[model samples]
Target: MSTSLAAAPAATSRRRAPEPPKRTAAERWKRRGPLLPALLITILLTQLPLLGTLYYSLRSQNLLRPETNGFAGLSNYATVLGDEYFRAAVVNTLVLTASTVVLSMALGIAFAVLLDKKFLGRGVVRTLLITPFLVMPAAAALLWKHAMFNPLFGMLNWLLSVFGVDKIDWVSQFPMPSIVLMLTWQWTPFMMLIVLAGLQSQSTEILEAARVDGAGAWATFRRITLPHLRRFIELAILLGSIFVVQTFDPIFLITQGGPGQATTNLPFLIYQTTFRAFEVGEAAAAGVIVVVGTIVIATFALRVISSLFQEET
Candidate 1:
């Protein structure tokens, strides 16, 4: 019996499938040729500008004083790193990104769960929920600034008056939170769409089996649904953070980076440095930093998405 079992393993090893033959150079080129134009265009549009930014970041350049432009080594980077306002902007960026992502994710999960259920007017509800995301960022910011947060004639102050509470200048008094709220409203729909896809993709049969096995709704969600949605949640948070960190429109429209520098973030700071301060070198350095940070987040997000796809396959 032992001899037969050993022989069986050897036979199985011999019967393993052979690898496919490699493609010829010409065949490979044929497959890749169709993508070359798009690839070249993308490089021209993205990589060239990035290289230009890096080149400028290494030198001292001021738009207002063009004659003083010359190589300054890493002085620009040092200046940006040492600037207190840059540090403050970094903190604001982190806080804004974290707050917006977390609040939107929570609201998204709730909305997704509600919409996932079979209910009357479900389609209409989903459509309405998704409208906020479809609205342009600039338009949405303006809408919130004028129609919602305006102290004199805004909906929020009017609502407060109904309860005899004093009118509050929301954007003036709470610049960061007001920005967070606007971002959350716009991005919650994006999160909801992703989470809703995950929810809908869940195996109903497994859920039914859990129910038959005496699992309650909360128990079923905790044990199975939550685990299944983990990847989706991660994806939503990563993507949301990546986008929210670059928030400029809402801040520009709603508070103009606040009554002070209260709402200034990395992007806004970069804008101020380039346009207002005319410190091109420092702004380029800051832009490079932001790009590097975004690339890191994007890399992790791509990995998570890849793993999710692999699991599905």
Candidate 2:
């Protein structure tokens, strides 16, 4: 019986699958022709501007002093590094991004857990929760500024008044927190959607087995569900950080980077440098730095995602 089994395996191994024929150049071109226009357009839209920015960053160009435009080497970068406002902006950007991502992810996980359970009006509740994310950033900022955070007649102050608390100017007094709150509110729904998808994809059989083994809900979640959701959580953090790091609308609309430079982040600083200060070269250098930082983060996130996928497979 062992000899016959070994012979059968050897026979099967001998009958290997046939290799596919290689296509001619024309055939390959025919297949790829349709995608060429889109590829070209993408290069034109993305790569060209990046190259232009790099070129500008090496120059001493200022819109206000056009005649003085000349090659600056790395002076623009040096200027940006030496500027105290730039350092402050970098710190603010990190703080804002970290705070918003953490808050949003926590709330998202809570909401997703609640939504995952079968309950009446679940659909309606989920829809209402998602409304904040669906609203335009500009509109959301405006709504928070006028309808919620206003010291005089806003809903928050009105609620405070009922408890005999003084009306507080939230944006002016707490610019960073105010911006973080708005961002967290908007981004929580996004994180919830990702986590909810992860939860729904879990195996009912495994959950039932855990329950049968005398594991409680919290134990099952902590041991099984949480581990399963790790990838989803990482993905949510990555995407949330990418978006929140580029936050501009809320700061611009609500505080205009604050009563001072209190709320100025990298993106806002770049805007100020280019349009407000008219320092084209410095702005370009800053823009390049921001792009490089974002790319580094995205690359790391993608590696994590790839490793997770390999583990699952």
Candidate 3:
């Protein structure tokens, strides 16, 4: 009887399924092995160029003076940093970036709030607004240069003549402002899209409550809408700063870093150093500095956004 009972338990145990084995890290990776090829390609495309740039930054790799090409240590960086042009470039970069970001954000918020409300043919209007952003940066800069700002024959001159005013040489007289205006015109649409998303995602209940409580449009905007869009505003400013600070196309196509280097930002300076002055190492170092500064700002912006998200949750 005892033997029969033991045999019954053994048979039941034999019929039962075993638990699945835990996957190791390698096994997990293998299971998702199809992504490996694409990831490797991305790394090759991005990381390889960055590594090459870093290596070149550490060496004296002048195309003009190949004989002087070798490991330069930090000498190239010192030279670039010590130059007066670099300091001026930094100042110009800050001015252009700050102006563009501020003006874009303001215009974007205004447009976003306006479009968020019901309107006739709003979709078509939104598409038209976003057209400038979709245009290529260089092409847009060229358009602004020749079509709008041309001293004698451009639209601005024509408009001034219509108004019985003096024609302004925009690029020659106000190079930085002209560049800022072009960039702001192009990038405002991007900021509007971001802010619009934030506006649309807002709590309808709160807005309706504000309306029911007799809160005016300005009051509601100040109390509820503005608070909600703060993070979006920060995000727009951060992104705009990153792109605007590295502006090259407008400076190149519109001003060519002139009216006496008035529009020469870091990227333009780097280009001037590399191609115009034939100082590859110095340009590489400047490029590294710009990249590092961008990364730092991006990190801070991301952290601020994350904190805002956490607060909401």
Candidate 4:
């Protein structure tokens, strides 16, 4: 009977398809212990605000109307979508983001290429070039607005005067262009830094081989350097667009969305809706839309940039 009982247990164990080995607590912790904490923290920080915003967006809460607040459903989204100002803000946001990112990336690539060569005072020059990006955004905007673009005593007008040209009101006369110029000035350095890193990491042997094959500077750059820099450029554009789309300090400090809402991007629009108009629900709805749009853009951008990691033919 004891033998039969032991055999029965063995048979049952075999028929059970041998349970997978149980991981030790230490092993399980080793696999996911570090990432679990960070993932939980990230979810807690990001999801909490998002949940609160979602709740707010679904309610008819307005600072102006204290007693009328209630469940509003999708009315806030409808209001925001139907508004002309929102539409204009969307367009302006697109233009501002596109222009700044493109110009900054172009100038950054140029500067990075030039700086990649061994030249006198290269360290000092690179440091000086990076100063603009390190400046606080509000301070940079203020510097441009008051010191560079002011029609009365700004340096730009003084320079124009030296050329026998009339002093022009920069912000009022060209609001969008003025904002673009300031943002480009500040962000180009950031893009340059990223591109320069990519340039320096390139294989020296590849460049030498291209030279040995009788490739001229332009040909080598067009075929070899440019291809290598493609991923960096895409990354720069992605990062630049993410930041530029949220431009607010420059608009607030320089143009104040003047010249009839010419410089108000989506972030500025959200600020206006929340504070100026006291429409909390609409602002939250706009925030949700912006988040959605950003996700959509980032999804496509990440896919494109992922191609850079594929084995090159």
Question: What's model 1's lDDT at 311?
Answer: 64
The pairs that clash in candidate 4 are none
Q: Model 1: per-residue lDDT, tens digit, 234-255? A: 9999988998998999888778
Per-candidate Cα lDDT values, in order, are: 0.91, 0.91, 0.88, 0.88
- Please give, for residues 1-313, the per-residue lDDT of candidate 4 as tens digits: 2345447423333334543457677876897877999999988999988998889999999999899899999999999899999999999999999999989999999999989999999999999999999999999999999999999999989999999999899999888998999999999999999899889989999999989999999999999998888888888888778878888999887877877888888998899888998989999999999999999879867766656544331
List runs of model 2 lying over 4 Å from the truth: 1-21, 307-313
TM-score of every candidate: 0.92, 0.91, 0.88, 0.87
Top lDDT: which candidate number?
2
Model 4 residue runs over 4 Å out of place are: 1-33, 304-313
Instruction: Check candidate 1 and list the clashing pairs.
Output: none
| Candidate 3 C-alpha lDDT tens digits along 102-151 | 89889999999888989899999999999989999999999989999998
| Residues 1-313, model 2: lDDT tens digits | 2345446523323344532356677876997899999999999999999999999999999998999999999999999989999999999999999999999999999999999999999999999999999999999999999999999888988998989999899988988998999999999999999999999999999999999999999999999999999989999999789889899999889988877988999999999899998999999999999999999889878876776665554
Clashing residue pairs in candidate 2 (N, C-alpha, C atoms within 3 angstroms):
none
- The CA root-mean-square deviation of candidate 1, after full C-alpha superposition on the true structure, stands at 6.8
Clashes of 4: 0
Ranking by TM-score: 1, 2, 3, 4
Query: Candidate 2: what lDDT?
Result: 0.91
